[model samples]
Target: MDLDGLDALLAKLDRMDREIEGDVGTIVKNNTIEMTQKVVKNAEFTQGYQTGYTKRNIETKIVSNLVGKTISKSEHSGYLEFGTRFMDAQPFIFPGFYNQKKQFLDDLNRLVK
Candidate 1:
């Protein structure tokens, strides 16, 4: 090809490259924005749920322990039970609270990646 024809072809190729780069950059920017919004929303929800659950659990345990202590002092003072049963009952009462919190954290980690 002649010099002018070759130059024109090169110019066209450069334009195409720039357009592709611009399109790719836009797509990446949009995806980043969407992912950021989702992460923020998930974090807010997880924090709210965790805070409420923790507060309630603490309150319930405090009340239950107080009542149990009072009962033991009054009637069942002689035979007091302590150890695994009392400790194990907490996880059971809360269901999947601990596991769910762990899973939420794991999901947040994945989102960061």
Candidate 2:
């Protein structure tokens, strides 16, 4: 091919390569944003589950302890104090609590993913 023609072809190829690179960069950026959003959403969900599980567990323990101690139902306002103390004294209760929480959270996570 003539030198002028060869040069023009090379220039066109360079422009095409630049366009392809730009497209690839856009795709990567979009994917990265999507991935980041998903991670944030998952983290929020996990935090919510942990908070709710802890609250319910505390309530249960307080009620159980108060009843066991023969505290009058009229005097106890839902056993909040007892629950807090019981949970503080026993850390292993968390695993069983989390296990029950996991069933619901796992289903939610599966749907989200």
Candidate 3:
């Protein structure tokens, strides 16, 4: 291809990259949420903890050109994670990210390509 053609191709790639990045973030967020829900379902829920689980939700926010997603339980999520007086720690957050890394990259690759 000529230089002009090459330049046009590069410009198109850059544009596609921007679009793919934004889309990939959403895809990652949705998939990660599934993992979070599974972990929550499998978690050992006592009396109070069970109530807390009902408040679980996911949120997506934008910062400049980036999209950020959060899987939130409640204000007491930290207490459940670290354990309080009579309860043991039951982590449900970090594990949500376990399957997301590879899936995110895969989505980026598929969308960008």
Candidate 4:
């Protein structure tokens, strides 16, 4: 068996891995931000900006290098998302998640390629 330039190849792969990690994190954070915006928009569309509480409460946070979150902090957010016995479900967050998912996936696929 003969091996040459394996160390250099490994070093290159390590660097590429690091770069990909950073890029993936950036993509996740950006997508979370966009998802937040989409959720707010959907809230507005579904709820008609009654008090603007949900829209204002929707926010994006980077939980870690590769993890991100879109949070709806309003106390009534869940009520509105899942609805109650008295009301039918008017889903903003779920719709927004579905809407932004394709873009997020495309962004990740593009990054990998």
Candidate 5:
């Protein structure tokens, strides 16, 4: 091809590379957050019974630095899940992650394709 046509082709390829990188990065980040949210929801649902306190307060939040995500609860929430000496540990968060781990991987895999 002539110099002009070759230059045009290179420019397009470079733009496409940049765009694909941006899109893939966004997709991965978003998918990760979504996966965390689903895990948190699973935990909430399986958290035994709910009077709307613990379950309602449960949250999935983005981690800093575009790292990933985290699941959290209100300050008093720790007591309900892990319990103080006066109470028993009900357990919720870890169990939720466990149940949804497979699905999380699946989400990432689909993004690759």
Candidate 6:
């Protein structure tokens, strides 16, 4: 049995693993920022001038190499997203998040393959 071929395969696998480690963080951060931008751009308020408050508060946070988040800092963000008995939901977060999430997963799948 030739052990040389096995060593080459293992070395190639190691290099591929390192490349993936580096790419994962970048992928997460990019997707998170894109999602935040989408949310901010699409977050519409009936009050025209007040729209800046919510858009300005929407931000992206990189938690770690493998994790990231899009946060809405405005006090009324939840109300705007989910709405209440008197108000209909003007959703901005979920649609943006899900769209980016799907692309993120597709990117990961491509990387793995």
Best-matching candidate per lDDT = 4
lDDT of 4 by residue, 86-106 (tens): 877788999889988999999
Q: Global CA lDDT of candidate 6, please? A: 0.82
Q: How well does candidate 4 match the true structure in TM-score terms?
A: 0.91
What's the alpha carbon RMSD for model 3? 4.1
Model 5 TM-score, 2 decimals: 0.50
Give the Å error, residue 25, model 6.
Answer: 1.2
- TM for every model, in the order presented, reads 0.38, 0.39, 0.57, 0.91, 0.50, 0.82
Which model scores highest in TM-score?
4
Model 3, which residues run further than 4 Å from truth? 39-47, 52-66, 109-113
Per-residue lDDT over 5-87 for candidate 6, one digit per residue giving the tens place of the 0 to 100 score: 88889999999888899898888888888998888777764232164888888889899998899998888878878888988
32-103 per-residue lDDT for model 5 (tens digits): 566556545654643333555555555545454335554556566576567679877766666666655676
Candidate ordering by lDDT (highest first): 4, 6, 5, 3, 2, 1
lDDT of all predictions = 0.36, 0.38, 0.60, 0.87, 0.60, 0.82
Question: Which 10 successive residues of model 5 have the least lDDT summed?
Answer: 62-71
CA lDDT, candidate 3, residue 8: 83
Decide which is better by TM-score, 4 or 5: 4
Itemize residue pairs with steric clashes in candidate 4.
none
- TM-score, cand. 2 vs. native: 0.39
Runs in model 6 lying further than 4 Å from the true structure:
1-12, 45-51
lDDT of 1 at 3: 65
Instruction: Give model 3's TM-score versus the native structure.
Output: 0.57
